[model samples]
Target: MQNMLLFFLFILFMDGVSGADETESVMEGDSVTLHTNLTEIQNDDTILWMFGPEDSVVSQITRKAGLTSFFVTDKERFRGRLRVDQKTGSLTIRNTRFRHSGKYKLTVSREQTTIKIFNVTVFGVVGEMDEVKSVSVMEGDPVTLQTDAEIHSDDLIVWRFGDKGILLAKIDVETKEISLNDDDERFRDRLQLNQTGSLIIKKTKTENAGFYELQIRGRESSQRFLLFVTGE
Candidate 1:
């Protein structure tokens, strides 16, 4: 009896793996919605959304006595970014990052657990033109890295410096918010992001002379700028 039960369980697991759906791609900083296709959730039903290969629970909805309550995991990467519809059990992830790319599984439970799988791919955004440009500036002069791409609400722009790729500033194009890395004091009060997703550094210094990289979400491309700072 023990050997027969093990074989049955193995068959069920293989069935679940074979039923997985095709892969879907979403640009970084955008949103992806997953649908359960159920018009109404029953009282005895439980719905769950899990991420990655580890199957970490991301969101859950439970219905009891006709009352539904939603719960999301305390995972740091998903904080304040997950939303679900109470009636449909659809899941929406907002402001997705590159690290969020992986397999997502949705489980529905009543008398038995039914599994549905989705593979999500998050693509990085780079510029459309030449990969790199050169900029020469003197101390105390402003320098701007220009890109002709239109900025969208769900897009994110990241600026990094040097070969080590130290983060300088990250801009959320939708919110028009700029978050400068506190660890890098060299750019304090000198960096600004324009409406066009261009980065403007107010005053250049010798220390700022290096290779800079700009990554824009949704474009799946990146641009590089080499800065040569001369003494004033």
Candidate 2:
């Protein structure tokens, strides 16, 4: 009985000496990897890994006894995705998503001394733009442009028009780009940023038609436009 008490005391002492150094970064689909040095731990020491801002217990491994245990939180997001490798102090998270981004801490305790702290980063999936079609607009009419979103995020909108590719107008939101070719030469002046990623060409004419394109960047997306000009 006395030996058991002493052993418990020793565990506390060792744990107190070493605190986990954790690093966190957002990852796509709710996944992340935690890495740290465990070389100094004795073959007999039991190491435990955990999750959450409070460092709630998640799993444990005893190398000397060849024993292991996993105790995960009831959170639906975690489910079976949280894992720990008994042979090494490595944690892997699968099926990551935006909501999975958060602070996590790890603590390693040996029978004698505590050694290192690791801070890890998990990357969140950011939306991105991949491709779009080139277009040309006429001198006086309305132009509509369009593109596909590769990822999901708040929409960031920017338009490029005119021969010099001047900045037009933007409505920062998640609306998809449209394919519109302007038809007003006065588009050079009457150009108005519209709700449809559309360009209004007040009065239809010949010179207003030309190449127009869109440049959009969002939390997790990007796009470019190419407007083609022609006589209408």
Candidate 3:
């Protein structure tokens, strides 16, 4: 009887450990869903979602006497990006960013306290542009940063240059606004943003030979290109 008791205790311990923690990996600008495996929530049950090392409360839902009250954290990183399902107690995060990578805890309170922990890792994605394709152009020629993807109305495109990552230009598809950061006059009127979020540089110079980066909002990754401008 003592041996059987020990065996049962060991099984319970293992089950508790397995049920307490989980790990997930997702790319930046992607969405992730954490499920609670609950088909229905009773009025007496309470659910809470917390994040990070501090375990700051991100969301909470309490049901009592058939009345439900839902609350969400006011943190800017999670604002307008979190969704909770009342029935299943599942949490979904939209457009996940690097700041969102951390530990998440879900607690359900009722007759028995249940806890679920998730260790989430968010990876930055490299965009679809060809990294190895060295764009060669002669001085005073025009060079286009090619982007093959279709642009959405709500999309935003940003261009940066060099190891210092200096912002060159930004284009907002929805607002149809193009902002040029021509602090050094490197790309003045010579720069143009096409409808497809590509950058066109007219009158390319030898000083333009460097690395350029292109990032699009709602995209899972950014693209980098090496520009080579040779003298005619």
Candidate 4:
């Protein structure tokens, strides 16, 4: 009975020594935040973060006085692409991708024994080009195209037209694809991505039209685009 009582006290002590949020959110193009709430440490406690789905060391931040930054052991593809909120201990990843989603573990340690657990989640935007549902383009004049992908961005995006099977742009987080075939040739360089994978075609004409396909690429996934051209 005496030994059992001592063991129970030890369990209680272990439990109270370290406590961290086991429910971390992981998303593509976004950093997942894991938090620790450790207490009762005589000296200092170390907080270590680990990731899987690729089985790599994500980062480690030692919780001593207040809070510190975690050294990303496997944040190669995620360099300059992730951020952690110091105040809230929240992690945010920029340009979230399908390959960037998975589970992570946080370990807290003092002297004798340490505690660790995992925070799992799936994160990333699909840039739904498949939901294009419909498309419309005009001749001689630039045709405006749209897609089902809601998070659209211009400038830093790729817009592949037709079945040419070529990457239109190098870096497109979320945006619609614009066809190279312009309505008036002059408007060829004046198009851009809209909120819904829609491309803004300028100077519409009768000779500048046809059915085009749209495809969206991400760090881990790709979406297809379908377009249609109409005569006015």
lDDT of each: 0.75, 0.51, 0.77, 0.47
Tens digits of per-residue lDDT for model 1 on 1-232? 9999999987786453224464566767899888887898898889989875457899889999989999987778788888998898998888987556556788887656778777665556754225556566777899998875666778898888765789888888778787876567777878877767787888877666656788987778677775655545
Best by lDDT: 3
Comparison by TM-score, 3 against 4, better one: 3
Q: Model 4, 1-232: lDDT tens per residue?
A: 9999999988877753433425444444454544444433233555555554233556555556754545654446566765644443334555655434334445555664454444343433455423333333444456565544445454344455432444333334433333343443434566655545556666654222222345544423334433333333
Assess the local accuracy of residue 10 in candidate 3 as a C-alpha lDDT between 0 and 100.
69
Residue 194 lDDT in candidate 2: 58
Better of 3 and 4 by lDDT: 3
What are the runs in model 4 whose C-alpha is more than 4 Å off? Answer: 1-31, 37-43, 53-55, 63-70, 85-90, 111-232
Error of 2 at 101 (Å): 2.2
- Which candidate leads the pack in TM-score? 1
- The window of 10 residues in a row where model 3 has the poorest summed lDDT is 127-136
Better of 2 and 4 by lDDT: 2
lDDT of 3 by residue, 1-232 (tens): 9999999976765443226457676777999999888887788889889875456899998999898888987778798899999787789999997567656788887666687877675656766323323466778999998876677889899988865789998999998989887675667667878878898999987667566788887876577666656545
Q: Could you tell me which residue pairs clash in candidate 1?
A: 124-220, 125-220, 125-221, 126-220, 126-221, 126-222
Indicate whether candidate 1 or candidate 4 has the larger lDDT.
Answer: 1
- TM per candidate comes to 0.48, 0.40, 0.48, 0.35
Local error of candidate 1 at residue 36 (angstroms): 1.2
Off by over 4 Å in 1: 1-18, 126-232
